[model samples]
Target: MKKVLVLAEARDGQLRNVSLEALAAASTLADGGEVTAAVFGSNAAELAATLGQHGASTVYTADHSALAQYTPDAYTQALVQLIELANPDAVVLGHTAIGRDVAPRVAARLGYGLVSDVTSLEAGEVFVRPIYAGKAIQQRKFVDGKTFVTIRPNNIAIGAADASKTATVVPVELEIKDLRSIVKEVVRKTSGKVDLSEAKVIISGGRGVKSAEGFNTLNELADVLGAAVGASRGACDADYCDYSMQIGQTGKVVTPDLYIACGISGAIQHLAGMSSSKVIVAINKDPEAPIFQVADYGIVGDLFEVVPLLTAEFKKVLV
Candidate 1:
């Protein structure tokens, strides 16, 4: 029986979907042993019931003013204390921005083997992860001490919520004394918009978008589908979109359920970030565009016309 500890992720005073997904993964890895979830943030204790419904048997919360915003040094310190107290066999986290930063620090401090961006788990020990910008997958196993892993969101199916289930919530008190960095304020680019990494559907544009005004059509389609908007590096470089919206080797990685590439030529760098999407749709006038190779569905046309048609159709269906 494996004892697993999952680090629950939350943002804007609400739990992130990947946090529950990580809990589900932890439950599977536990294999009938025990699954504990650790949440850190201001008022994070309120999320205990939700975590329990997903699969956590016990929830540890570190709620303090210092933890309200994410800072690498502070988060790592909190996790280090939790790990020392629980002494779990394995520690799991979602491969989000915070997890990517803090997981490595905790692993190094605790002398644990770290596996980042794992996509699959087999027989509780073997883990599968992508290599070389998702060109290949490699399966790895930790031969020794505690295993620390960060799972990619959307790859693993989330467990069903059982409202009848409940977890024992434990409040952990830690003396977080860090003198290095702190987030005094957060400036958001697309505030209140769907997080690109966690969105189920996404609509992205590329250099073919021509200008910033071209993104309006994609945004309309995204609004109809309740999807996030993204852009290729070429689009950002061309000043057609913001760099925060860039999706590629140099930008954010995404794995939405339905990824619509509008006017994107599908450069290798662009594909490296979103190829893991479950279903890809490419819309471009160039029939020989590289994105069509990986797309489940392809449309050879101008996105300015294609996108409005898609948006109208989706609005009708959604309404």
Candidate 2:
């Protein structure tokens, strides 16, 4: 049987939603073959069961203190062994920080072809990815051995409950080697807000916000709507906010159920990050703002007046 391997990601012993999405994609491509998922961390067996709920038939786990914190060497070594043992037709992963770092390394080690940031995957000789910062879509296929693909999150929907199935956990052996690079410490961002990548709704501010305080209105509106906050490249470049909040060609990509652009000019770079949003609402004083072109609903008006009204209306609806 042609097995398909999916690398799962978890935090604090819980599976990431994107990892489940990867499992969903792999299951579809498995073609009746075993859909196996591998997770590295402590108490990963429980996470393996979660994968089963998403269609993973077998789950491989490697638990160790070194695996607790992301050490590329340790993870690569573990995954390398798993791939060799399972011999999957294709290995899939979430295009996150860890996946981006490890997928290429795994491909290089196996001397196989890799397609990164795939927005869509189908059972064919070819794979698809975005180019020119999402301005273009390109498809390429490998004539060589097994293919490796890292899928961008939010591009695909996750699987619903299948309580009849449960993922079987298989433990893996590990060889701890001296990593050339050692992680000294990980300083997490202090923000208590939901991660923009995982957020279902994102309300982003841009140059139209006009000031650092301008983000305050966006925040108020976001709070009422129960959404995460984001910023545009133009807003970040103008020093209205930190780069971490920036979303554009050079920044993090987000695809939420609803993406609200307040004052953003909607440059191609900015659109690349958020064009995938299911429902886009653009509020700009200038009707010609490029962002309005893609918006499902456009409000050409001053944000200062528009945002407060939105916040108030949403507050009432939410309450």
Candidate 3:
């Protein structure tokens, strides 16, 4: 039987949600095969147990000080060794920052095929992914010996957990080599309600918002709905908001449950980021705004008047 491997990511003993989703995908792929997960951290055993609940049968742990920091070389070496030992038919990973860096190198090292940012996976290893910045969808077939795939966050629903199951932990033997790049310092913004990519719901603004103060209205709505804030490329380019908040082809791609676009004339680039959302609501005074074409719900009215009303109504209902 072919074996499926899931690369798990952990931070301070807490497992990343994407890892569980990958496990779920692995479980589906492991119908007649074995499913396993691998992690590199101190408490990887506990993380392996959690991964088992999602369907991993075995877990490989590689704990070391060099593995603590996310250096591409260290992670690639660890995963390369694990893959060499396990020799799984397929390896599943989250299309996250770390995975994006390491997955390709691992594939190249093993002379394996890779499909990145996959939104859907099939039993036969057929995959679906976005192209041209989500403007078009592409279905791809993997006709190779071994395959590596990365799952886009929020695109796949996480399966129910089975806590009764536990994965066998296998420790990996690795020798760290001095790499070219070193992480000097890690700095994070202290003020933020949620990470845009991880947010379940998001409220985004655009050039029509007029000024930086326009984000205030969107924030009110986001607070009422407990959603993260987003901005369009136009707003970011105009210096109305930071580049981090921009959602477009060149920016972050998000697949939240609910996406609300305010004062935004949806361009194709902007739609690429949030178009995969389950529910899309657009508020624009222009009836012909491209946003309406994709929005499940559209309100043709000034955002200044419409957003406050929606915020008030949401606060009243939820509170």
Candidate 4:
């Protein structure tokens, strides 16, 4: 039996979906032994019940002014201390911004083997991860000692919450000091309320959208479906959109329930980010585009004409 601990994430007081996914992944690594979760910041106690419902036997929370916003110094300090206190056999975290930054720091500090970007797990310790820009698969395992892994967002399924379960919330304080930099405030430049990583649906555009103004139509379609808007590197390079909206190997990897590609030529780099989506719908004039090969549905036409039609139709069905 394995004991697992997960570093959960939260944003704007509410728990991020990836945190629940991390709990689910932690439960998997525990294999019926024990699963514990850790949340940092002011909302830890407030979020413990939800963590319990998802199978966290114990929820550890650290409340500190430095942890109020994510500073690597404060977060790493707290996580390393928690791991030491719990002495868990394995550690799990969501493959998100915080996880990407802090997991390696903690593992390096603790001298543990760390596996990142894990999409699937079989036989507990055996982890399956994507390599070479999603063109290949790599399976690796930790033969002995503690195991640490970061699971990709939307790649793992979450178990339904149990109302009967209760988790013990422990408040911890870390000796966080020595600040090289402090994030006093954060300024966001995102288009939608739904996070691109956790969105169930996405409407992406490429250079074929012509200009930044072209994205307006895609946004209309996205608004109707309540989907996030994404862009290819080509569009970002052309200055048609911000890099935050870019979806490719160089950008964010997403696995939404539905991905609609508009005017994208389907470069390998772009495909690497969104290929894992449950359903792909490609809209491009070229019937020979590589995206068609992976798309469950394809529309060959001008996206300007097709997108508005899709938006109007969806308004009748979904909105």
Candidate 5:
């Protein structure tokens, strides 16, 4: 029997969906044993019930001033203590920015091997991770000792929520102190738009969009669908969009439910990032654009004319 522990990550006082997805992965890792969770900082307890609904039998919360905002020092300290208390066979985390930075510290401090960006679990023990820009997948497993894993969001299927199941909430005292950095304030890039990494639908522009003004058309469509806007590396390199919105081999890897590629030529690097999307829609004037190869739906047209038409049509259907 295996016991799994998941770090229930919260952002802006709200629980992140990836944390629940990680809980789903934890259930798989548990292998007929128990699944537990932990949330840190202010109002941590409030998030415990959600973890419970997602399959966590017990939820541990650690509240501390140092943990109010994410700092590696404070979170690492809290998680280390939580690990000691849970003594779980496996530790699972979402592969978000905070998880990426802190999971390594926890593994190193505990002298455990860590697996990052795990995409799938096979045969109960083998973990699958995409490598070399999705050109290949590597299967990994723990030889001995506690297992530490960080799962890529949207890859794992979140299990059914059981409202009947409730977790026992426990408070773990934290001694977090002497943080090297504290976030004074968070400056958001988008004005309350959906977070790109977790968005269910994504509309991405490419260099073929011509200019930053072209993105405005895409943004309009994104707003209509309540989706997030992304860009190909070519678009960012051409100064058509911010690097933050870039999606390619060196940029963000996204696996949304629907991915619309507008004016993208489908460079291999760009495909590396978004090829795994559930449904891909590619719109381009060129019939032979490489983007068509992976697209579930393809439209051959001028985006300037096509995008507005799509936006108008979608608005009628959606709202």
Candidate 6:
């Protein structure tokens, strides 16, 4: 039985969905062993009950004002100390921004093999991840003493919560010092309605979205579907949208349940980030657009006309 430790991530005083997804992945990796979840931040102890329902037998929380915001040095120090205390056989984290930054540092410090952006787990320590802009998949295994992995959100199913179950909460105190940088404040462009990475449905636009005004249509469609809005690199480069909404190899990776591509030419870079979505729908005037190759449903038409129709239809159905 392998003991697994999951780093449960929280943001804006709430737990991120990817953090629970990581716990689910940890449960799978544990294979009947104990699963412990560790959350770090001020007042993070309040999250223990939610973590327990998801399958964690033990929830460790570190509440400190110094740990309120994420700083690479402070987080790395806290995680390293937690790992030493738990001495888990495997450490799991989400492939989100913080995980991508801190997982590598932890692995390097412990001299353990690290695998990032894993989409699936096979028997043993083997993991599956994308390569070459998601054109192919590669299988990897960790033969070291301890294993560290970062799971991509939406790829792993979140376990059903059992309200009857409760976890043992352990509060820990850590000495955080020598912080080179601090996040005094976070400025957000979006209204903080939904996090793009964790959104179940996403509507994306590309260079074909001619101007900033064009995004309003996509946003309308997204609002109807309760989806997050995203753009391809081309759209960002064209100044039609902000880089925060960019989804591609050079930007945030996502795997939503439903992905709608409006006027996107489906560049390899863009596809790399969202090809893992469960259902892909592409709407473009060009029939030969590369997006159609991977789309579960394809519509060859002008997005200007098609998007509004889709939005209206979804509103009727959803309302």
Could you tell me the TM-score of candidate 4?
0.98
From the highest TM-score down, the ranking of the candidates is 1, 4, 6, 5, 2, 3
TM-score of each: 0.98, 0.94, 0.93, 0.98, 0.95, 0.97
Model 1 has an lDDT value of 0.91
CA RMSD (A), model 2: 1.8
Q: Tens digit of lDDT per residue, candidate 5, span 1-319?
A: 8999999888778888889899988888888899999998789999988899999999998888888888898889888988988899889999988989999999999987899999888875899999988888999988788978999888898888889999999988877777788888877765468778788899999987999999999999999999999999889889888888988888888999999999999999999999989999999999999999999999999999999999999999999
Residue 173 CA error for candidate 6 (Å)?
0.9
Span of ten consecutive residues with least summed lDDT in model 3: 186-195
- lDDT of each model, Cα atoms only? 0.91, 0.85, 0.87, 0.91, 0.90, 0.91
Can you write out model 6's per-residue Cα lDDT over 111-200, one digit (the tens) per residue? Answer: 877999999898886799998888889999876688889999888888999999999999998888888998899788874656899999
* Candidate 3 per-residue C-alpha lDDT over 104-163 given as tens digits, one digit per residue, 9 for 90 to 100: 999999988898998887767678998987778898887658888898888777988887
Which residue pairs clash within candidate 3? none
**Residue-level lDDT for 249 in candidate 6:** 90
- Clashes by residue pair, model 5: none
Window of ten residues with lowest summed lDDT in model 1: 188-197
Overall local distance difference test of candidate 6: 0.91
Report the C-alpha displacement of residue 146, candidate 3, in angstroms.
Answer: 0.5
**Per-residue lDDT of model 1, residues 92-188, tens digit only:** 9999999999999999988998999988888847899999999999999888788899999888889999999999999999889954988899998
Clashes of each: 0, 0, 0, 0, 0, 0
